[model samples]
Target: MSALARTAARLLLGSAMVGAGVLHLTTQRQEFRAQVPEWFPVDEDLTVLSSGVAEIALGAAFVALPGRKRLIGGLLAAFFVVIFPGNVAQYLESTDAFGLDSDRKRLVRLFFQPLLVLWALYGGGWLRRHPTG
Candidate 1:
C-alpha cells in the first residue's frame, strides 16, 4: 500500500486501540474478562486493567509519535500476537465474549487475530520497509 494508506491505517488502528483500551477499563471489563485463560495466574480484572493501560499507551504512541512509528508499530504488532492465546482459550473453552456465543462464531473470531497482527505491521510500515530501512 501507499504511504498515505499506511498513515490512514495506522491512525485508524491507533483510534481503535484507544477505544478498546477505554472499553477494557470501563464497560467491557467483564466481557474481556471472559477471554482470560484459566491458567493465567493473575486476577482476571487486573489482567484486563493492565492490558487496557498498555493498549492506551501503545495507541497514543501510534498516533502521536510519527517519528517512532516503526518502533511503535512493531510493539503493537507484538502485542496483538502476544494476546492471541487468550483468544484461543476463549474459543477452546467455549467461553462467550464479544457476542461470539457459538462455536462457529468463536472459531471465525480466531482468524481475526492474525489479521490484527498483519494490520499492525502493515499500518506501521513494518511490512514494507527493512528494520533499518
Candidate 2:
C-alpha cells in the first residue's frame, strides 16, 4: 500500500481505538459496576478508569509513533495480553459486561480480541506493508 493508504488505515484504526477508549472512560463507573462481578480484584472505578487510560495511551502511541511503531505495537500487544483475563473474566462471571448477551456470544469476542492484538503487532512499517486498504 502507498504511504497515504497506510496513514489512512492507521488513522482509521487509531481513531476508532481512541474513541473506544474515551467511550469506556466515560461509561466506566455505571457500566462496570453493573456488569463486573463482585469478586474481581480491582474496584469498579479503578478497573474502568485504568483500562480506558491504557487504551487511550496505546491508541495515541500507535498514531503518533508510527516511525517507532514496532516499540509501540509491541506495547499494544502486551496490553492486549494483559487485558485478556478481563475478557475471560467477563465470560467466566457470565456477565454481559460489554453488552454481550451471554457467555456463548462473548466467546466470539474472544477470538476477535486476539486477532486485533495480532493486527496491531504485525501491521506494517518494519517490512513491506500489507494490503490494509
Candidate 3:
C-alpha cells in the first residue's frame, strides 16, 4: 500500500481507539462493564477503566509514532487478541453491548476480530512493506 493510505488507515484506527477509550471511561462505562467476563474475578469497573487507559495509550501511540508503526501495530493487534475472550464471553453469556443483541449478531461479531488484527497489521505496514531474507 502507499504510504498515504497506510497513514490514513492508522489515523482512522487511532481515532477510533481514542473515541472508544473515552467512552469506556465515561458514558459507556456501564456498557463496557457488561462485556467483562464473569469468571475473571476482577471488578468490572476496574477492568473497564484499565482497558480504557490502555486504549488511549495505544491510540496515542498509533497516531504519534509513525516511525515505530510496526511495533505499535503488533502491540495493538495483540491487544485485540487479548480482548477477544471478552467478545466470546459476551456472545456465550448473551450479554449485549454495542447493539449486538442477538446470537447471530454476536456470532457475526466474532469474525470481525480477525479483521481488526489484519487491519492493525496492514495499517502498520507489517504485512507487505518489509522483506525478509
Query: What shift in Å separates residue 110 of candidate 3 from its native position after superposition?
Result: 0.6
Query: TM-scores of all models?
Result: 0.95, 0.78, 0.94
Clash count (model 3, backbone only): 0
lDDT (0 to 1) per candidate = 0.92, 0.71, 0.93
Q: What is the C-alpha RMSD of each candidate to the true structure, in Å?
A: 2.4, 4.2, 1.6
Write down the worst ten-residue block by lDDT for model 2.
121-130
* Candidate 1 per-residue lDDT over residues 1-133, each given as its tens digit: 6899999999999999999999999999999998899999999999999999999999989999988888989999999999999988888899988899998999998899999988888888888955473
**Which runs in model 1 stand beyond 4 Å of their true positions?**
129-133
Across 32-118, the per-residue lDDT of candidate 2 in tens digits comes to 555445677888777777777888887887888778777776777777788777777777777776578787887888888877676
Clashing pairs in 3: none
Report the number of clashing residue pairs per model. Answer: 0, 0, 0
- Show where candidate 2 strays beyond 4 Å: 1-6, 32-38, 124-133
Candidate 1 similarity to native, TM-score: 0.95
- In the range 98-132, model 3's lDDT, one tens digit per residue, is 89999999999999999999989988888875657
